[model samples]
Target: MGLLDNLKARLAPAKGKVSHLAHEHGHKVTHGLDRAAKAVDEKTKGKYSDRIHTGTDKAKGAVDRLAHKDEPPAGGGDTFTPPRTPPPAS
Candidate 1:
């Protein structure tokens, strides 16, 4: 009945459709991310390996969540998993 509710109702279907599309195209998204990371790493000659890898992993995990959101995720959705942080240097 309210403006926000009405807008949400109208866009709900669109949201689901987009999620489905993302799920279907997950592989391509993944490949693109990898390629970009490799290129960046090569340009930087492995100087940023740890940071780049962490970022790439987080990005891939986000894609996985978006793609598998409609159905039960391998670990289920909205589980609030923590991001991977680097270990403290000895």
Candidate 2:
């Protein structure tokens, strides 16, 4: 087996544990993130509010993804439809 495959095999249990924990405590994790972001933003007097908001959003998204990694995609299937564009003016 390749080194990467060996590593993955070893870490599979840990990944499962993490995924379970994330799913179980995702709400608390996200709440903590929001609380911490508020404290930091308050300390910085809102100077970094925008950046802080962005970071917090990304962290929450990561947590959400981890928590839902095993779930099937919504909408029943993977069918996708592209938006139609208007015709260009002559």
Candidate 3:
């Protein structure tokens, strides 16, 4: 293997262990993200409320993606969650 591949090989086991830990404690990690965002928002007096919400959403999505990586896109075993469309106007 090339130097890069050899390095990756050596790191694979550690990576796997870290991944497992993250999966097990994913909710706690998400909570910490929420707390940090709240702290920033309070420190700035809600000046960045919009951006904070956006960032929080993106972060939550990422956490969800990783937490569900082993399951098919849909845990229901459908392999996907169809994008929902808005209801037609009355």
* Model 3 residue 72 lDDT score: 59
Q: Across residues 4-86, which tens digit of lDDT does each residue of candidate 3 receive?
A: 99999999888667667778888898899899999999999999999998999888777766666556555567656766997
Cα RMSD (Å) between model 2 and the true structure?
6.2
Clashing pairs in 3: none
Judged by lDDT against the true structure, how good is candidate 3?
Answer: 0.82
Q: Write the per-residue lDDT of candidate 2 for residues 13-51, one digit (tens) a residue.
A: 998788889999999999999999999999999999999
Clash tally, candidates in order? 0, 0, 0
> What's each prediction's TM-score?
0.61, 0.73, 0.62
2 or 3, which is superior by lDDT?
A: 2
Query: What pairs collide in candidate 1?
Result: none
**Candidate 1 residue-wise lDDT, 1-90, digit = tens:** 999999999999998787787899988988999999999999999999889999999988888777775465476666877769977889
Q: Where is the poorest 10-residue window by lDDT in model 2?
A: 69-78
Query: Which stretches of model 3 miss by more than 4 angstroms?
Result: 1-3, 73-76, 79-90
Q: Candidate 2: what lDDT?
A: 0.91
Give the winner by TM-score: 2
